[model samples]
Target: MSSPTTYHLVRPHVVTEIPTLDEHQQQVVDHAGGPLLVLAGPGTGKTTTLVEAIVRRIDDGAPPTRCWR
Candidate 1:
């Protein structure tokens, strides 16, 4: 005979909040208008940095239509 496994149910709220970017990430986000390249392994926040930069520029009055990925 096999015994049944016990499971514990945890609420989603138990998880901690997302972390903020580090200094390197902040630098990437603060770059001015010009050509830029991000080279790193997967899960290294490349996309996140670019997204933040775009949003920051837009928030600072850069036209959304003029921005490119």
Candidate 2:
């Protein structure tokens, strides 16, 4: 009889600070329903802001599909 080898996957724990969104970004994220448009110049945290909004919706018990059309 031969013994089998086992491997365990491990992920590193990362600590990151949540970005502090400005008033403009906060307004966009707070609007949960209806159609909304976000336009801004470069380095305006567009991706981060949108991602945080989606996360907020999910955390609020909204279905993933409901976040989109």
- The sequence of per-residue lDDT tens digits that candidate 1 reaches over residues 3-43 is 89999888776775444878988888887757877778999
TM-score of each: 0.62, 0.68
User: What C-alpha lDDT do the candidate models reach, one value each?
Assistant: 0.78, 0.86
Clashing residue pairs found in predicted model 2: none
Worst 10 residues of 2 by lDDT: 60-69
Q: Which stretches of candidate 1 lie over 4 Å from their true place?
A: 1-19
